[model samples]
Structures are given as structure tokens and as C-alpha cells.
Target: MSDAILTLDNVTKVFGRADKPVYAARAVSFALHPGRTLALVGESGSGKTTAARLIMREYTPDEGQLLFRGVPLGKGDARALRNYRSSVQMVFQDPFASLNPTHTIRYHLERPLKLHQKGLTSAQRQAAIVELLERVKLDPKLIMPKFPHELSGGQRQRISIARALAVNPQVIVADEPTSMLDVSVRQGILNLLNDMKAELKLALLYITHDIATARYVADDIMVMYAGQIVEWGAVNKVLDDPQHPYTRLLLSAVPDPDRRFDDVRFADELGRVEEIRTLSARPQPETAQAGENHFYRPFPAV
Candidate 1:
């Protein structure tokens, strides 16, 4: 995207010895644009969290770089780093663990305003907190004074979203924001994200293993496997007619109410799971386009 607020340019993060390297992220590249969401979909060990950590600056890239608004990160001075921190906010996976049990929702939202949004008077900060709470669909009057422990899973997650918004961040990296909540409330959170993206024009990086939710909330999608982005494009194009074998493998696993146990396509993909994993792990720099917007790495030779 030409107007991407944040871009990962050929970023790589590795662990273990140089001779026997473990690739957590290998040449991963994508962009997050304002008012749109880029979903990173993968299995648990497929380097999804590693990518989030890279953006959060909890772990530095072993190769390549992160570009925030066209400027390379880590090279800038402390003030630039602080600006990056406030601009890129993270909503973690677990709402229960992300917030303090003792802290009221008001406190959680107030702290960020005090830090990043300095110069707000006490009354102004309180108003800002109320606005944030309302933005996330929480009733400020009822929610502000309640401790994290008093809220339901979904409400606490809403508070998490409110807290992230407190900094007036341009980008939000939500790592499985709805996974812990009941399936009934998941859509509410997703709707809130979509509303925030449209109304506030915030760029969103939604990281999840759930294909159904990805299809619902994302504008674009990247299918990651074995530390590499094997396929990516407009969400409907990529998910409707997946090109990569690994991408097909993931779609095969999603429970289909209409698909029978003896469905041939399901059996075929599931049968090659091991083979697909083995081949997908090998580095494939070559790319192939399936459609105008859909693209994938060509499957390696067996």
C-alpha cells in the first residue's frame, strides 16, 4: 500500500546457532494502512507472535528493518523511539492477564493519557478516559470504577481496546483479541475493531489462527507457515481460492458444517499435511500470482 503507516521490509528474526538456525520469521514483508486491516493467519508455531514481537520492539530483527511512516526504526534517537512507542500500540491475546486486577478501568486508561498525551488537565484526562471507554462500547459511568477482576472476559477485552486507544495510536497490533471470549461475544469485539478502523481511520494488524474471524474482519490476509508468508492478498481472493499448499492445508482444517467426513478434498489435503510442512519449511524466494491481487510462493519440489 502506498499510504502504509507501518511497513516491514524483508524482516527476519532467527534463533539458535548460525550453523543450525531456527527461523522464527524469514524475509517476512507486509504493510499496515490506515482504515484497513491486515490479518496474519497461521498455526501457533508459524511465527505469528514473533512478527508481533518484532513490531512491538520486544525483539529486534536479525535481518532487514521496520519502517514506520517511511523512516527506519532503531536508527532514530530516544525521542523518535518514544514517538514510535506511542504511535504503535499492542492489544495482547489474553485480556485476563494483560490488565492488573487491582487497577480500575479508569486507571488503566488514565495512565496512557498522562504519559503520551501530556498537557491534558485532570478533568480533561477524565473526559478522555470516558471517551475511550465509550469508543470501545463500554458504559463509562459503570465501567470506569470497576476493577479488571469484576468484568466479564468480553468487557475486559473491551477495556484492553480502550486502553490501547488512549495513546491515540495510528496502528494497533491485536494478537488474538477474541480467542479467549465466548464465541457469542467474539463478533461484538470484531465489530468494534471494524468500527474503530472506519471511524478513527486506524491501521490494524490482526494476528489470529482463526480463518473464520480473519475472513470476517480483514481487508487483506497473509498465510504464514514455517516462519514465512507463503500466500497473501485481498482476504476473499486468498481464502476463496488459496494457491499455496500450506494455505489449502489450513483451510482444510476449518470445520465445515456442510462438509462431510468423507469429503475428498478434505482427505486429500489432510493426507499431505506432513509433506506440505516439510516442503513449506524450505526457503522459497520465488513468487507466483494466482490472480490480480492473490499471490503465493511456488511449492518447492518434493
Candidate 2:
């Protein structure tokens, strides 16, 4: 997208020995545009978290560059770095762990304001905190004084969201935001994220292994395997017609109401599909367009 707030241009990060390096992220590329959510879906150890880390600046790319508002991120000065930090925030997978048990919810929210929004008076900061809680659909009066231990998983996650918003960030990297919550409250968190993306025009990167939830929350979808984005495009087009074997394997794992538990065909298909998994560990740079907005790297002939 031309107006993307953040862009990962052919980014790559590796670890292990030079003779046998592990490509955590191999020539990975994607952009986060405002008012949109790009869901990064994959199994554990699939480099989804690696991509998030790259964006968070927790791990700098061994190759390629990250551009924030069209300027190279690594080349930024101290003030620019501070602006980048405030502009891109993260809502982590574990809400309780991301928060401090000793601190009140108010403390969690107030620190960001005190740091990034330095001009705000005590009263204004309090008002901003209240507004943030309300934005995440929490009751500021009730939640402000509670510690992290007192709140449920869902509530803590909301507080996390509120904290990210405190800095007025443009990009939000939500790594498995709802995975730890109960199934009943999972939809509520997804809904809140959707609402926030629309209302605040935030660019959101939602990382998860749940294909079903990705379909629910993302405008665009990218399927990662051994660090490669095998397929990506508009959520509906890619999910409905998954062109890559890895992408199809992911969608196949989601619960299917029409398929019977004892069906021999279903089991056989899964076994056959799994063969593609090992092949994906190698780099596949070739690509083919499946639809106007859909694309995938072709699997080597089985």
C-alpha cells in the first residue's frame, strides 16, 4: 500500500552457525496500513513471533530494512527513534505477564502518558487514562484501582490495549492476543480490536495460529511457514481459495462441521497434506498470482 504506516521491505533475520544457519525470517515482506488489520497466521515456531520481534525492534534484521512513514528505521536519530517507539506499540499474548502484579491499572496506563505525552498535566493524564479505558470498553472507575492479579485474562488484555493506545500509536503488533483467554471471551477481544482499528484508524498486526479467528479480524492475511510468507492477500480470497499447500493445511486444521469424525477421507487428506510441511523448511522464492489480490509461492511437485 502506498500509504502504509510501516513497511518491512524484504526483511530477513537468521540465527545459528554460518555453515548451517536457521532462517527465522527469510526474505519476509509485508506492510501495515492504517485502519486495517493484517493477520499473521502460522503454527508455533513458524517465525510469526520472529516477524513481530523484527517489527518491535527487539531483533534487528541481519538483512533488509524497516521503513516507518517512508524513512529507514535503522537510520533514525534519537528523537526519531523515540517517535518510532511511541508510534508502534504491541499488545502481547499474555496480558498478566505483560503487566506488573504490583502496579495498579492506573499506573500501567499513566506511565506511557508521562513518557510519550510529556506535556499533559496530572489532570489531563488522568482524563486520558479514563478515555483509554473507555475506548477499550472498560469502566475506568472500576478498573483504575485494580492490580493485575485482580482482573481476569480478558480484562487484563483490555488494559494492555488501553496501555498501547496511551501513546497514540499508529501500528499495533498483537501477538496471539486472545490465545490465553477462555473461548467465550475470545470473540469479545477480537471485536474490541476490530472496533479499535476502525475507530482509531490504527494499523494492526494480529499474530495467531487460529485460521478461523484470522478470517474474523483481518482485512489481509499472510500464512507463514519456516519463516516464509507462502501466501497472502485479502482475507476472504486467500482463505476461501488457499493456493499454497501450507495455507491449505492450516485451513484444513480448523474444525469443520460438515466433516465427520470417523471419515476416512478426512484423515487421509490430513496425512497427505502434512507431507508438504517438511518441504516448506527450504526457501521457495518463486511466486504465482492466484487471484487479483491473492498470491502464493508454489510448492515443489510432490
Candidate 3:
């Protein structure tokens, strides 16, 4: 990732006592460049969310550095840290939980401008809120005064994106933005993310367990397992030509229009998942360049 807007340098995070430990992240590393998205995919308890937490500054890395615009974060100058907070906003996993039930959407968007762009007056801030709503394809006049429960799931998500843009962020961390929405609406949310990335030149971290959705929004993909990135590369290259057993296992779960999640198939693969996990959890000797753009760790001999 050349000219990255955000970079995690050998970042590590742990949860538990010093005597015993649950290693949530182990030397995890990656970068997010402007106008591109990096999708982090893995099953439950696979450290996908932990990585997001680290980038969001909800959890500081116990072991490594987080760099924003080539400057190392944590203990930076007051002005620099302020910029980081304002410029790196997150769209959480649940739109319903993230928004304020008591406040109107206009209040949510206006407060950020008040706190971050103090130069803007009340009239200018109000105008900017409407523009943001318009940018996300919402009717500002109709939706601005509505509370969270009043809008549809997709509309709430668009409001979340609009609020994220309120601070004029250069990087967006969207964790499973569409996972909870109806399938019919998922594509619309994905397309909105794609358009935001291209038009605003915003770097994005699109985190999810679903590789199929990852393909729709990201340019690059990283497959995580047991706190390590087992495979990564260009999204299509890695998905179409997966080199890791774990990656293949995940890809196998996607629903095809003709084939549902259960259609009398994958019985054998489902039965052998424990074996795949066993092999995948073993320490890899090194990364192997398995394709022109794909890379993964080979399973150790049984």
C-alpha cells in the first residue's frame, strides 16, 4: 500500500492476566491507502474486530505503532491528535445502537462541525449538514429532523456515513456496515461506500466475516485466523485464487443465487472444518507468494 493514509506497524494486542493470556492480535500488520478499501475477513473470535478497535483508538496497541499520515500516533502533539480524531471517524457495526435515540439526525451531524470546525457559524454548519445528507443520497429536508427509530435501516446507515463525513474525514473505518440489513439493501450500502471512496479519495477499512461482501466494496483483502493474517492480496486475486486453507473454507460459505447456504452440499467440508482450523492455527514458517498478487502461509505437515 503505497502512500498509505493509515498504517499499523506490527501491531499487537492482548487480553488477560500477565501469567496467562488471550492474544487478540499477534504482530498484525497492514495499511490503508486513500481512494482504496482493505477488507479484513474472518470467522467469529478471529481478531477481526480487535484490529478495528485498535485503529479506532478504542484500544491502544500493547506492542506496536499506529501511523497516520506518516506520523506515529499516541502521545503525538495536541493538534495532531485532534486531527486524527476528527479525520478518522468510524461507522460501527450496528446503526441502531450507534445513533442517539433522543437526538435528531440534524443534531448528530451539527455537533461534529461545532466541535471540529469552530470557524463555521450556525447557518454554515446547518447548510453543511444538508449537503452531507444530500451527498449520501438522502433528502435532507425530510430526514434531518427524524430520530434513529424513524428511518429505515438503510437510511440510518446513510446517516451514519453522513455523520462520518461531517468532520471531513480522510479515512473511514466501517465495520460490517451492511451485515444486519436485508439482502436487497446490502448492495445499496456497498455501492454508497464505493462511491464515497472514489469521490472523496477516502481510505477505508471495510471489516467483515463475509468475503462475498468484501469483494463488492474492497480493492484488497486480508484473511485473518487466530489473530494472524493467513492470506492477503488484491481482492479478486485472493478470492478467485485463494492460497490458504482457511481462506478457501470461508469462500466455500458464500451463497450463490442458484445455491443457498444449505442445499444438500458442503456436508463433507463442514465435517472437516476442525482439521482445517487445526492446520491453520499452527505457526507458519513464512509467507509464500502463491500467485502474482496472492500470498498465504502453507499448512504445516500433520
lDDT of 2 by residue, 1-302 (tens): 54989999999999999999999999999999999999999999999999999998889899999998898886557787688889999999998799999999999999999999999999999999999999989999999999999999999999999999999999999999999999999999999999999998999999999888999999999999998999999999999998987887777777879877787765665887647888877789888999888999998765
Q: In terms of TM-score, which candidate is strongest? A: 1
Which tens-of-lDDT digit does each residue in 167-218 have in candidate 1? 9899999999999999999999999999999998999999999999999999
TM-score of 1: 0.98
Q: Model 3, residue 62: displacement in angstroms?
A: 1.6
RMSD of 2: 1.4
- Which of 2 and 3 is ahead in lDDT? 2
What shift in Å separates residue 97 of candidate 2 from its native position after superposition?
A: 0.8
lDDT of 2 at 211: 85
Better of 1 and 2 by lDDT: 1
Q: Which candidate is the best by lDDT?
A: 1
lDDT of 1 at 301: 83
lDDT winner between candidates 1 and 3:
1
Candidate 3 ranges beyond 4 A from true positions: 77-80, 257-268
Candidate 2: where are CA atoms >4 Å away? 75-78
Worst 10-residue lDDT window, candidate 2: 265-274
Q: Lowest summed-lDDT stretch of 10 residues in model 1? A: 73-82
